[model samples]
Target: MFDQNFIENPYPTYRALREAGSAHWNGDFLGGAWLLPRHADIAPVLRDARLSAQRSHCYSALLPEPVQPAFAEFNRVFGMWLLFQDAPEHTLLRKLMNKGFAPQVTDLWRDAITRTAHTLIDRLPAHGTVDYMGSFAHPFPALVICELMGVDARDQAEFIEWSDAIARFFGNPASSLEVAYRGRDSLLAMTRYFEAVVEQRRHAPGDDLISLLIRIEEDEEALNGEQVASQCSMLMFGGHETTRNLLGNGMLALLRHPDQMQALRDDRSRIPNAVREMLRYDSPVQYLTRIAAEDFEYAGAQIRRGQMVVPLIASGNRDETRHADADRFDIGRADTAHFAFGHGPHVCIGTRLALLEAEIAFDALLARCPHIAAVDTRPEWLANFGFRGLSTLRLDMQTQPADAGAVAA
Candidate 1:
């Protein structure tokens, strides 16, 4: 079905789909999926404001009937949150939420990100190998969000567990009902937890994002406690999970290609470009599906209204028409446009924070641990389809510490 074997790896499958034509839909398995690889086709689809991420407009009906109720319920609760809204409503939600993600806010976080990088790495085991994903990458953003949200230190562990379980929806197919139910319960628990936090902030606020949200609420009648809570929860989970994969997956890219790693080590300034290369080479998010609001002709196939349309973003990153030697991982590639952060109005609002966190984290890791290599042991892939990353990436490092002073000298 795929040019690439779907079981082991799907990139080859995506490549073949792209080669076949611009937008191709295959009903082979997983309830049918489409691949919109061409830029010309993807741009129009994203710009079309009538479509949305809501389940009602879902391009894919692969989800079981029972599962839709759970998802639909969650969608109803989070309706005002930007991720679920479209067009004019989406614009308002995005505008408000983006206040916290403004350029000034992102710039303010540069130093905090640096400190976070150092603090996380310093805690790693000195000589023995460690699961960089668990010990470092995942927690890095979690800590940042905790501090940013004024989450009590005591509650941090619970938050991680809740996030992990809710994250499983996108993970590989569930083993049984128990897992899916647990994941749903975790999502509800998290929503309730944040709901309380939002109320708490309303009564006894601090100088944090939550407080700012309350202030936004007072000024705008459009927002309320439930709205604020939903948005905050979305930001918390989205920021934490997507970035965890970015740092962890980006590091994996470097380990798999030693030459690029060496270059970053030799000239630290190249870290910025190297980060972009990492983004293009191994995007954090693999696929994004957008529902077609109306019938549209694409790649010789006719798409019906409310049909699910998935942009195989990972495939688009490697489309020969868009990128030269698309499969090759070259840090020096001039033309780079990977849908890592997505595209269009619904694009990731936390992109600046994400990129900032990645740049600082990568710079610190390479500067601190030289000749770092993926451990001989098998690395753990987080069993999620919505995202790709290591569950636990054990890595070997240079026994000698490479502190700030050592690197400078």
Candidate 2:
């Protein structure tokens, strides 16, 4: 599954897997786990109480001796992340974190998001080619999240590098020892950076997420220093990683289908629906891991406790039973119930923010770049299986004049 071809396009393999069975036993991958590829099966399993999000407790025994120590730092950092927690603990943390991400708070940033999008668009060359991913897609959200988190503009590059390094550990459990050590170092560095930031906020808070988290108290409980640092780390990384890919992938999808691009450009009203379809067509996050907390019978297969259950979300999005003509990419597709942001209790906390960011991004891009075309139709894909994104997306664009009313409302 880690093969380069599979990383580039796993849909073919996913269809084959789903055809074989709803769930398949893969003893070779991740030391014996069940790969669930069908939407009929994956949807329910995601919401099942028996399936636990805390994989470390279930898969610890499978780790090799050398990798276990490195994972100690990994777990210490990611374990506290709301995505990996369960039950009351998950409930508590989510409620506390939600204060900083309230809809009103996110809505307030719309103007800033639009301004940021326009600022990045203005930097694009009028008639030259540029790698959209690096120039705009990647850094746009990174800058937005940094502003929200009270991070210094000068340190944006370092923060993004740290987040990228840490993200390697996800969806690639069989990573080499070198990658494992690098992830460990990245985690340690993030921990130290956030630790000092949290301390600074505690003494003298600001109007950032870190300050809000420090002051937020629910049921007489508040996030401690360690928890504050961990949540900030997750938000800083999680905030932009998937959203960056969404922008890149969404634009590429539009470029591939000229009709859809024209439809969106003609009617700005279609941009929101187009963003939803883009997420469904090529989800940013492809797969997630869950562990069976207890024995359960699923699709005639007996799942044992402590066994890994891998849900192929990218495949599920294309499942025929759930979506009509699933293979086709239509921006106007009515059924937008894709599992791109996941499902059930663990759905992405930043879903609202991501959607808003993508909406504003596409709006600005279409308006500012009157004629956008892909320089390289076949761009390289990221090696990680968990997150589906392009490594680079080169594009040649024709920028509208400054007074051409290209600025998004």
Candidate 3:
């Protein structure tokens, strides 16, 4: 039996796990593997350098023996993406990717992304609502990454569809093999497509990231095509989909916490803090995984080597010890020391960029439409354990200026 309920909504179980500490539950409903829910217990394990992010750790004895083989390919290929890797390799790959994302470089995309946000919002029907995820959330990030990553604007919808399919491979164990298989195939196709794009850039490089990759691939760094493809895939997912969910998820938070939303409207200066609070309160990513090294002791229990360690980072933000009043949403709150971007050497590289896009996009929307509200619909959560974001959210609002409409009234 799978825990679909927990998958659909995990906060309650997370609370139980926290209160219960690191308890082993092979309950009738919950199947396979032990659970660790406490924020304190999970954090050190995630930050533990001894616990590796490699294949050996992933195939730990703590995991069901049958699962080991299934996760083999994932552990292997995923290493190229840098996010899953631990040290020098991680450092090198992140540095190369960061080369293109230099502070001055990402700043260049601000106007384009901001303009794209208004363009998407403008297309919404007058006095009605649209699926914020499909229209606004999904497209904003898609177009931003497309323009920045050198993908044609026409290909965004495909990226959105494929990324959604693959996102299910994360989080819970019940994710269908069909989802994983299809997602892998989709990634392969994209990689093949990127291969040609990278090749073209090799001969005729532009000022884009693809061009940057082409340049780096040739240098002594000698990053192979497969590695380039790996980074490309990371760029597509991390650059596009996560931002989509952040905007959508962040907006949903505002809807739920109108006080915070009102706080932004009351003062434009509060947008930055509000964005951080939104990320901390309910981040786009919820869980991260690691594998134990040698036998280690945690919370009076001996965690054997090769045991799979899952740290609930979202829960970590709500960690009472780390954050004061962990559950409440306070834009002005001072101790917002959240692990939302992750922690350690592998924290998200695009953190500053994500925060920038969120703040500017949210600011533009609130300024244009004063009386914004979520349409009557249930927001869908994505299918990944490592990400927390809305599948879709529809916002109902009126437009302005006749051309802009009369919505803000």
* Top lDDT model: 2
**Superposed model 2: Cα runs more than 4 Å off:** 56-63, 401-409
Full-model lDDT for every candidate:
0.71, 0.84, 0.69
Candidate 2, residues 126-182, lDDT tens digits: the string is 878899999999999999888888888688898778877766656565766666667
- Candidate structures ordered by lDDT, highest first: 2, 1, 3
Error of 2 at 108 (Å): 0.8
Candidate 3 scores a C-alpha RMSD against the true structure in Å of 4.2
Who is ahead in TM-score, 1 or 3?
1
Candidate 3's residue-wise lDDT over 1-409, tens digit each? 2255654566666666677676443432113334565666765666778777763223222345665565555545555677777677777777777777779988887777777767776787767777777777778877877887777999888887777766655444444557655655666566667788887777887887777775763246766777777778777877776777678778887898888888888997888888888878887777666666678777656667766566677776676766777788898998667777778777788887788888777877777775788875566766555566777677787654223332221
Model 1 error, position 316 (Å): 0.7
* Model 3 alpha-carbon drift over 4 Å, by segment: 1-8, 22-36, 55-76, 217-219, 383-385, 401-409
lDDT tens per residue, model 1, 242-277 = 888888778887788788888788888887787777
